[model samples]
Target: MKRTTGQLAVVIAALVAGSATAQDMSKIVNTPHNMANLDVWGVVIPENQVCLPCHTPHNARAVEDGASQILWNHALTEQTFEMYTTAAGHQGGQPEGTSKLCLSCHDGATAIDDFGGNEDTFDNVMIPADRLSNMGTDLRDDHPIGIEYPPPDLTGYNDKSTFTGVKVVTINGVDRVECASCHTAHDNSYGKFLRQTMEGSALCVECHDK
Candidate 1:
């Protein structure tokens, strides 16, 4: 049976829409699960050695500072990070735990291949020296994290509940924003691994008044 031109147009539209859908995996190559494929995490691990870059099955690297721990396989960065500050003369600095874990890979101080007891799995596997994604030891320009925000009910936000309602990963009993608060490490359901849509600053406005 021959389909009308209008029918073909509709079918094509649907196909295009489906291709752009959030969960479309082909459009998602840089998600954390596929870190080996990223320039920041540039390396070619064996198919079986994927997670070995950041995780391990036995005797994982122990988190040295904070109480929070993971199966962390990568070596932590050595630099003392200059954290974000509020208007009150640079208070509210210092990332807690999970954020530090991300910095292990993104802070541009640690090597992408610097994991598994600092084993050299690949040559020159560190992230490039300079890039926006390569957030250096200085974090003054970035959004504030590791700082306490008003809990449960806050009057500054349009929806005070929205402020506290969104994901807030705590470390060592402190309610602070870590990298994972806005990001999904293994999932790209939202672009750039954001936990929710940032459209119209949808994610920001949820917690801010503006």
Candidate 2:
């Protein structure tokens, strides 16, 4: 019997839960070897409500561009970035997924003090203009996103078909790359939510035309 991806997720979650408790300050104040751990712009978020900088349990709300199923407690920034693509071979399109989440703080466009619970309006919130440093809106030199990985013919990849986990994601009749497709939200041996181990260009070739 073949186990589905959903089944695998359940198993991974169960394993993670058994070893860890609710995300607390002590867990986040330290290093970020795991997802439950927190690292704000490479700096450890201090204990207190600061941990609420991103994750929250009660009133978490999703951002405008992300999946509505998940709750987001942070106020997402509006800045854009250069994404990765094959045209430049090094550039990318619009930033998405965890990268977007990372930029919410790293971009410096939004105030760190402004959280989901804050009553301060967007304009009222003051983020330092000089401190703000971002990749910017043109994503040609970053990494490519929002592209479908599946081919019209699946058999061409031969035995590598199982590894080709790409799926179609259509938004308003247009398609975009979803974070979950390449990055497993649950337990993974690889860093940065990657779906598989990284040895040379293994992860990139998994979906690209190469």
> Which 10-residue span in candidate 1 carries the lowest summed lDDT?
151-160
Among these predicted structures, which one has the highest lDDT?
A: 1
- Tens-digit per-residue lDDT, 1-210, candidate 2: 899999999999998886555434133333242322423333323354535656677778666555333566666668766555553242324555554665565465655545655535423333345542343455454345555444333323222345554343444454455555555444344655466656776776666546
TM-score for each model: 0.77, 0.50
Where is model 1 more than 4 Å wrong at Cα? 1-14, 17-33, 39-42, 65-67, 151-165
Candidate 1 residue-wise lDDT, 1-210, digit = tens: 899999999999998888667446433343555655664445666563657777888888888655557688877777788876666543455555778788887788677777775464555455566666788888888887776554334455453346532576666676656677777666666667776687788888776777
Error of 1 at 73 (Å): 1.1
- What's the CA RMSD for each of the models? 4.0, 11.5
Taken over the whole model, the C-alpha lDDT of each candidate is: 0.67, 0.51
Best by TM-score: 1
Each prediction's total of clashing residue pairs, residues at least 3 apart in sequence or on different chains, is: 0, 22
